[model samples]
Target: MNAVLRTLVVLVSLVVAAPVLAAPAADVDLVKQRVAKVGVLRGEFSQEKQVAGFKNPLRSQGRFVLAQDHGVVWTTLKPFPSEVVVTRDRILSRQRDGSSRVELDGRQQPAMRSVNAIMFALMSGDAQALAAQFTVKVEAKANNGWSMQLSPRSAMLGKVFTGLKLQGDRYVREVEITEANQDVTRIHFSGMSETPAALSAEEGGKFE
Candidate 1:
């Protein structure tokens, strides 16, 4: 079978299996509550991107900081150095020299605004927000861990991303994004630290 056809089969199988998917909703609620109490989070991440026809998956490593009140700072340290800051109002990409390479105001771009909301929901573990945009299924695993599958509800988004799978104990540790045409992006997060204190000036400045 061709790659596109194979991907369609995989997606169809996932949808057909959805009826049997079941887990404790209360457990997910408790996990969301625990995540809500965390105001600041810092972690390191490694990401792998696979595209159809590519001989090898592209790999990148990075660190990130998420402040509920401020925004998110994502620094890519591998392959090349780059940074992206996403806030409620705008998204900015900064070069290694601390100059802005690109900036998109959410007020002007509806698509970008939606992207910002989804990123924040993913980073914050906002179950309510996530549920509003995707159909979710949760399953508990051994060792106090859990997994969730989220399928996009919007037709437009469905064309871009068919589904996402997230796994974690208390905080999100891994995310797998399955897109149309059989491409996939997987991110693994580790060394997470959650704090109640505010972000430092430098971290906060990224959003500005």
Candidate 2:
């Protein structure tokens, strides 16, 4: 697979999946309702990747800022620093040396235009947008928390992912992606805060 496509798949897989939601319609609605309340979210994340035949999992920790209408600034702080900025129109990756590496311009490639759509949708907790791509199943867990399992409907994605799961309370807390190649990536998010005001100057610059 192409590296860019692989990146897109990973980003999209973080949010969208297929299959069904086992919970009742009302419960699903409530989940969506709670998720929609988040606007500006800042958090820290720990990501673990387990690959087939690998002796140990690859792990990284990062900070992320998600502006519902703008984009996402994902900054990895440990295990090799890097940053990725995803907007509605493009995806930009930068190395630790402050040099640009990959830039995917959605304006140039029509297909890439939606690169961040599902990702933002997931971050925004839009169940309707998620249902368009994945067969969704929702589970209401204890302590006001909820879990969702999604299976891919697209054959292309099915080749890469076997299943995807998300869990959270008022805000999304974790994402688990299981690939067909016997690999998995699990991201746990913490220290999340939903800001009452708009994005700051530094945060807003990521989109540009």
Candidate 3:
């Protein structure tokens, strides 16, 4: 081949091969770091719940917040104003009637236990962490997004839902959590990102 033609061919090969390589673990870690920096997440979601003995699946809508270093605050905005606060130490809940209840160990209530399991799944995308609780696998990948499939690792989780599809898109597009007994709960998050603002102790009192 001519000198100029050979030089051109080598340059094209390098350009084509560069993007085909997968990023290192550290590079992948950067994606999580940027997400964690926001410090908090506020979102709206719709839930469909079905249990072992329920005749019909229950449908509800609500808002939730995940505060940095504290815990998550889940507020039901439709069909009720019930709220669930899950902290590092315990899980507390309230209803529209202003009644308060606390359950430190999720094992106490079947529903709370199921809910907590789902919440933790949405917190991070660590492969090992999720694999421990669910049979997780990559479903698809693209330049802009990816999809992961997960099934509860435990029978208790299976009692709540059969499978889940955690889709990573513009701000975690959708969390499709389904009940093993034929109920489905798909929650979509939006208009939320990490913020530098902090939740005040007094302001947070409304939660407890």
Against the true structure, candidate 1 has what lDDT? 0.70
Candidate 2 stretches greater than 4 Å from native: 1-6, 9-27
TM-score of each: 0.81, 0.85, 0.65
Who is ahead in lDDT, 1 or 3?
1
Candidate 3 weakest ten by summed lDDT:
1-10
**TM-score, structure 1 vs. true:** 0.81
Kindly report the root-mean-square deviation of model 1 from the true structure over all alpha carbons.
Answer: 7.7
Q: Write the per-residue lDDT of candidate 2 for residues 23-109, one digit (tens) a residue.
A: 334346857766646568899999898888999998989898988778888888888788888888888888758764777777775
- C-alpha lDDT score of every prediction, in listed order: 0.70, 0.73, 0.54
TM-score of candidate 3 to 2 decimals:
0.65
In model 1, where is the ten-residue run with the lowest total lDDT? 1-10
Which pairs of residues collide in model 1?
Answer: none
Which lDDT tens digits does candidate 3 get at residues 1-208? 2211222233233332222222222223323433344456666777665544677866777777776566677777777667667754456666647765534443543334334433554654443445545666664456556566776655544554578887764356677766555555566666665553776674377545
* Angstrom error at residue 127, model 3: 3.8
Clashes of 1: 0
Candidate 3: list runs displaced more than 4 Å: 1-37, 48-58, 100-102, 105-118, 140-143, 206-208
Better of 1 and 2 by TM-score: 2
- The local lDDT score (0 to 100) that residue 1 gets in candidate 2 is 29
